[model samples]
Target: MSNLKGLAHLRMSLDDIKSATNDFADNRILGRGGFGVVYAGQLPTTHRSACEPGTPVAVKRLNVNSHQGDKEFLKEILMLDSCKHKNLVYLIGFVSEDTERILVYKKEDNGSLDKHLGSTDLTWEQRLRICLGAARGLEYLHSSVGTEHRVLHCDLKSSNVLLDANFEAKISDFGLSKIGPKNMPHTFLATVPCGTLGYVDPEYAISGVLTKESDVYSFGVVLFEVLCGRLATVVKSKDEYEFLSRLVKKYYAEGKLDDIIFPGLVEQMKPGSRELFSNIAFRCLNQDRKLRPTMRTVVKELESALEHQLINLDDDEEIIGLSGSIGVYNGHELVTSLCFTTNKRKYGPFNPEADNRFSGSWDAGLFDGFYGRHGSYIDAVGCCLKAAARPKAQS
Candidate 1:
């Protein structure tokens, strides 16, 4: 354990952590899980660098009675310190003194992705981007992150994905992670199958053989959660709980997935995008682990899905005008409605509303297309400009 303290991560004192978190006050708690309670707090002064002296941070204090003990805590610290990627959560420091076990991470302002599962404010584009980011993070883990071993995120779920202020996804929670030789493709580790109820891979559970496919299976459940706007598991009755994976596979096979897709999200998805996203997600749930797509393949498919979502007008068409309404939703000002006018015809007044009406038009010049900033909603929008083609001279 002494060698762990010698690692590059800042070693924070328990006193400093207690002071920042007000001794883990109830009000400072961000969330709780099987391991322990997470508290919102400030970075200890001892570890201050380019950032402010007391920059905000998240502190996860391990519960004394948690099933996850010192071994898991130490593993998390080692795994996180070894793997570093933009999409993976950044470990600021840790406190492992006496009986206390705490982890400090850079604060993700938007919190976990699970909190916004059923939120109408989260647009389809945002969901796709979040999924893509998470896939990339997992790909890095499964491949190599400047390490000889490939890390397997044994527990993958929506709640484990943190969102930054820009809504970028960051994979977190590494206590359950395991590593294997990077060169092995068919690698398998015999261990107790342990993960969240709905997200656990069925094959892994039965065989007690864990592999990279197990993570992919969990990721598939998360993808469906984003599409369905709900958790992977829901209580149907006191004794019976419905799993999203089963429901997704059923709806997908019957070609009735639209019936279960989150409201408003379907309207935002192009047929190509929706089909591609759903297809890959369904494939990940394949009972045969050999048939599941690798994280690398998953990332490529998600990229294609995003590309399909963007508007691609015909060669002859150009934007002629725009109309939309801006309004506040849940305290955030966003473009609540929008529509496009082309030289050929009007497209639509999508998400149409009457609040704070606005419009713009041009009789000349080329309206290349549209561009804007978006997250939970379209925060702002602007038109692309290109010089109009002059009429061909008489031949």
Candidate 2:
């Protein structure tokens, strides 16, 4: 524990930790896992620590009887203390006195990404941003964290990706992480493979040979989880579990990815953005480890995907009305023409037609956008409206 001694500034007494967590009250607990329970608390700033005084924090108290012992605890402390990035969880301090093993981290207001999966609240753009942030964090760990060695996050899952108030991702949990030689194309370590079931790399698990690509494989599962809006593993029955990685590969190969895409997300996703994002995600899951892209490439692709999504957001324009033509074609009613009316001028009458026309005009309220179904042609149409802004009183 000599290395721990050098982190004295980050060491908090057991008494302080207990005080912050109200003596491990049930209500203070934020979450629980194989390691232990995490508590929400506000530690006094009196101690010389990384966080502000009285800042809200999450204090993870390790289970004494759990598999994670002093060794794992020490590894977590050392890993977090050395690696610092905006997209990585910030370690505030720790308590390693007597039988207790606790680590404190800056609290993330939005919690883990897993909690929001399959929910409509998270927009397509927000999910892309979250993925990009996590990728950057992983890239930092894999490339630049250490002078002689790069870190490999053996466990990369949605639960480990925490989200701040702004929905920025912060990769957490480093007890199972390993370090490898820097600048090596593939540094192999013969060790027992360990990671979350579905997220674990099959090659490493079967051969007990670990490499940087193992982390990439796990990250690939995470990318698909975000895109599909589900966990990597799902309970199929009492004795069986389904892995999302396999399903994604099958779906991608068959070009049936639309069947598994999160319900509302497809509507928000641009075709090009979805294509780019899914292509990268599919490439990540390739069976050949050599084919998996480096974390740097993953970051660039995510950036491009985000840029593609942002191309026609029309953030500057305030839409006020919509006019379009609907006609019956081949026994199906379809929208044939559409135009957006903004504060400045009309945008378009795409696929214009004069017959079977419908128009909606609003002056005070804002036009959110149009929503409808589409096949070979637009099948139906509806618009989203927002209440007008309340006028301010004169001073």
Candidate 3:
């Protein structure tokens, strides 16, 4: 094993974590998951640490009853330490004492994408940025960077996509993440199929063969969810439920996709951008794994769609500001911004493990509020300005 001391991540003590979280108060609880519970915490020193005590951090404590073993726990910590990217969530520190294990991460004030799905506050451009951020994170995982093997995020879902104060999306929850073999020409790895119910890849579920393509399939579902402003699976009636992909394909086949597109989003979407996104979503959802595009291709298509969305905006000072902010001119190529707009007060701390019916499943008249919501166009422009000011390029 690599020397743990050489790693850049902090090896935290349990006593320090206890002090930060006030002995794990209920009020400090941020969310819960199958593996463990997450609490809102603060480190004592911001000067020497990634965050100050005033700046909140999230502490995930593994449950004593959890099925995860020491091996899986070490894998998660090492994966977070080894992988570094702007779009991917990073570990601040960890604590392992006796049977207690904990991990710390930078707190995202806006919470997960699932919490904001049906809200109209998120604009099309903001949604595009979120998608672009996630795509880039997945690309980094699939890309051979910093390691001989590639990592696969087995559990890719809206709930796993976290938004910072700027609403910049970062892929989180690496408990189910896996790493592919190094220097092998193999296209897929065989492992037990495990993922969320709605987002699991159909092929992996049947054959138990894991691959980067599995993540691609789940991402396609998320794409449609973002487009339609609904969950991946919707309840049709008491005994019937419909998957969003099947519903979208049916609409697309009948030449009436607009019928299903989120109401306000249709007005904000540029024709070219919408077409490109739809095409990519379709290709990503291909049943034949061999036919799916690689993560690199997915990132290119998403960036292309973003370019169209930006190009369609009215040419004003705001537009120029937006363009300048997200587009960084490094040498010759421009790496655009992937920031977003969010309302901090809209969503309070949520129990990620607790299933809220209103947010989890669809109800009759669920589409009512989703259609009439409106937001300012300047959010994108403002975000672009922020992006342009950063001196260093991000992965």
Of 1 and 2, the candidate ranking higher by TM-score: 1
Query: For each candidate, how many residue pairs have backbone atoms clashing (under 3 Å)?
Result: 0, 1, 4
Tell me each candidate's RMSD, in Å, in order. Answer: 9.2, 14.5, 13.0
Error of 2 at 192 (Å): 0.6
Q: State each model's CA lDDT, in order.
A: 0.85, 0.84, 0.73
Candidate 3 per-residue C-alpha lDDT over 1-395 given as tens digits, one digit per residue, 9 for 90 to 100 = 23455544477878888878999999999889888899988886532466555567789999978866566677778888778888888688887778888888888889989888888999998898889888888988887554578888998999899998878889998888888864653357888888987788899999999988999999999988888999998777998878987888788889898899888999999898899888898888888888988877887787667666654322222211111122223453332322211221111111111221222222222111100101111122211223344567778
Worst 10 residues of 3 by lDDT: 368-377
Where is model 1 more than 4 Å wrong at Cα?
Answer: 49-51, 314-316, 319-395
lDDT of 3 at 190: 88
Order of candidate numbers by lDDT, starting with the best: 1, 2, 3
Give RMSD (Å) of candidate 3 vs. truth: 13.0
| TM-score attained by model 3 | 0.76
- Candidate 3 residue 26 Cα shift, in angstroms, is 1.1
Evaluate residue 366 in candidate 2 and report its C-alpha lDDT on the 0 to 100 scale: 49
Task: Give TM per candidate.
Answer: 0.80, 0.79, 0.76
| Model 2 C-alpha lDDT per residue in residues 1-395, reported as the tens digit of each score | 56588988788988888888789899999999989999999977566665667888999999999888888898888899889898999998889888888999999999999998888899998999899889989999998898789998999999999999989999999989888888678877888889999999999999999988899899889988988999999999998999999999888889899999999899999887899899888888777889999998887788667756654435456677778788877998878777778776775554336588899975635455554433234545565544354345689
Candidates 1 and 2, the one with greater lDDT: 1
TM-score, candidate number 2: 0.79
Leading candidate by lDDT: 1
